[model samples]
Target: MAPSIRLSPAARSLFDEPLAIAVQGLGPRQQVTLRTSLRDETGELFQASARYQAGDDGRLDLARCPALPGGSFSGLEPMGLLWALQPQKPFWRLVKRDVQSPFLLQLEVFEGHGERPGRLLAQAQHERAFLRDGVRRVPVREGRIRATLFLPPGEDTFPGIIDIHGFGGGLLEARASLLANHGFATLALAYYQFEDLPQKPKELHLEYFEEAVNYMLQHPQVKGPGVGLLGFSKGAEVSLAMAAFLKNIMAVASLNAPVAATCIPFSYKDKIIPAATSYEHKAKTTSSKFLDYSDVLDDPFQAPGNQSLIPLEKAEAQFLFIVGQDDHVVKSEYYATEVCKLMQAQGKGNFQILSYPGTGHCIDPPFFPLYPIGSHPVFHKRAVLGGELRAYSKAQVHAWSQVQAFFKKYL
Candidate 1:
């Protein structure tokens, strides 16, 4: 027989009052039972019992007794469950029933402070762009590309949109899919598989995206004349650089993206360009080295260095800069200000800039669960405000509408 485990006084206080639990671990293929008792400041409030079964593989199976006050303890869903777990908070506990191998067990005292029913209003919104059909894949350059082309469902030809995903993440994300649902012929290009890790930015190539754009223009569903470019984070920077250097791009929208250059070295024609920039800019200030990526590689279009390497002044496409005020990830306002300054200096007035307050880096459409609010893991010193995923604000929705209108007028 193994020893039983109990909850600490501090841990019990988190459950709204005081709670006690006794857990025993059975050997593999055996089962152990648990009894949970709860009390308020006054006295006993409720009592419950649960059963735990030990599988042959040493995994403990937890089942709640139906007679318990909370009914059952079903686990959380996959994607939405991220908000349910507390990051960097000691909100969970583990109890062991065995001494040697110590059969492990985890318990969460649910006082209902997390994202569960009766908490926040988080819903998923569904909208489709192509009135007639769903997404289809097209073969291009010996490889297949997944794309969603949306027309007005009439005989009219509409402007096209090519959406690029950010670093490491995949194309199946809500951002690209939602844009396609909104009547844009969106091509969510998967630079890397979600299951497969991506190489560092320095190893990326610009020719692949150029090839993607060319393929989109050749598609029967896409409007042949030109197409708009939309990207977030690293993808946004790529879109901006492509618009600057590529002749076919008609418009670009960059969202909360870093303008730093990459580290890969490549030759555009015969000239070698550096990979990324070396500048160290605070949230609102830019150093002279900010655009200098020439030291690393000759191809400035690769990553960090692409900021100053691509000549936006020579770009023919209209641009839109969308940023969140509370975006500590990339310092949205700083990029917006710098880009606007450069555009103005080049006598380019065909660009628009919009910002939203109380919003974090990923301004997902309304209904998605918001990120957990706190300092970012990458930039631990900086504050990150995470909460229920925010949908496009009325103002943001209006801005998106304007973006569509702008592309329609230009592209």
Candidate 2:
């Protein structure tokens, strides 16, 4: 009998869900190479390979067998083939530009762990879909709101949540789609780098975000006394500003963003949250030839600089600060800690922080490969988004669960 690759369930599955992998009908104790390959919407190839041996029973279950070194990853990672995948192109991050489509994965088994695997004995294909079958993807084009709303299937109404991507711009619906699968009617909102919006806007206004919050609260499929905000990088900073001034905001989940308005100033109704002085002149060049932005943004704790700090004590929403300790892109952990002190001074305890050491910037949904470095979305220059792959992957999974639980409990 020929060896065959098998996926535990049907080939169709959510991008965030994990599937079992195994190779059957192989010779007892046979050494083989397992490779997984897939192309993003852009036609860029991403692939991973692992070496393993069948048990005495002639079955190789990834859940039971530990992967050997000298491959993409090693040890007992059942879903390593998916997460260990790296792009063939340099500095290319795997992004799901169109959530309406699925990423098809090709899995193959070969005879040995050579530069070229000896024989292609087994092959299987799987589709990692972004949009769930029952979930509805609706494009939002209300006044001043350029976004996509994702609602769970059926007559049931889900809690409302707003998801914002980084300063890099564009509407990223993948995260919102995943959250909608778990019963949150999420809106992936875009502020810039999108249709008719400027690529390099000088100022960010919270009024635009306020419109999104109101839109969510008023949505028929969305349930809310208030809505939650989930954001990354500059998006997180915007969330913080909205939380501070906007009404009916139940929670804010911030990922690796500044505590104070920086890079770009944020403006509300009448006043402005002044941003720290720019210090691009002070940025250090990393060994990888990318910029290390760890110290690029000025500190918010010092005098005059505190003028840019957001006063979250005025906010009615609970806060969840997810920090990556080794994040060279920004001082995430430091910001989280100082904010805690400031909140304590004001006698407010509406914030919960989850800090992960060795984790870097860019924490996406679970099982996605780690993006150690990429061009800064705002700068268009290569920058270090530091992290150890395994640690960052683990952080991504745990942080996602924590965020869901936080939203469920509070929002």
Against the true structure, whose lDDT is highest?
2
lDDT of 1 by residue, 67-172 (tens): 1223222232111111122212221111111111211123322222223422221111111111223433332332444433333344445467877765444444
Clashing pairs in 2: none
**Model 2 vs. true fold: TM:** 0.98
- What is candidate 1's CA lDDT for residue 22? 28
What would the per-residue lDDT of candidate 2 be over residues 157-256, giving only the tens digit for each residue? 7889999988778888899999999889999999998997768778898888999999998888777799999999888989988999999999999999
Model 2: weakest 10-residue lDDT segment is: 296-305
RMSD of 1: 16.2
lDDT score of model 2?
0.88
**C-alpha RMSD by candidate, in order:** 16.2, 1.2
Candidate 1 yields a Cα-based lDDT of: 0.48
- Model 2, runs deviating above 4 Å: none
